[model samples]
Target: MVSDRNMLANILRTELQIHKSSFILGSHSLICIFIYSSFIHQHGGRFHLSPLREL
Candidate 1:
């Protein structure tokens, strides 16, 4: 039962992280256009994760 709960929590956390990443991308694009007149042609506005996540 504890393992099952942990799995569920892990899934939820991953989903939330994906959602947050998308949000940050969207916000970055919006702010870049607002301040710079357009989105920068770079890749700093991305969120990357490690190969293994234990959290």
Candidate 2:
């Protein structure tokens, strides 16, 4: 179960990084990214999504 959660987190992080540049180009995309980051922060803990902090 823990591994599955970590896998999901990894996938999410990868996807976020892949699209992050494009996201910064649009206002709506910024909102979506903020929501995604907040959701991850709440559910996955800061450690799991620490890479996003650099963005």
lDDT of 2 by residue, 1-55 (tens): 9999999999999999879966667878788788777766876665454555755
lDDT of each: 0.66, 0.76
lDDT of 2: 0.76
**Alpha-carbon shift of residue 35 in model 1 (angstroms):** 2.6
Worst 10-residue lDDT window for candidate 1 reads 46-55
Supply the TM-score for candidate 2.
Answer: 0.39
Minimum summed lDDT over a 10-residue window in model 2 is located at 46-55
What's the TM-score of each model vs. the native? 0.57, 0.39
| Candidate 1 lDDT over residue span 12-51, tens digit each | 9999999999999999998755644322223354433431
Off by over 4 Å in 1: 36-55
User: How much is 43 displaced in model 2, in angstroms?
Assistant: 54
> So what's the TM-score on candidate 1?
0.57
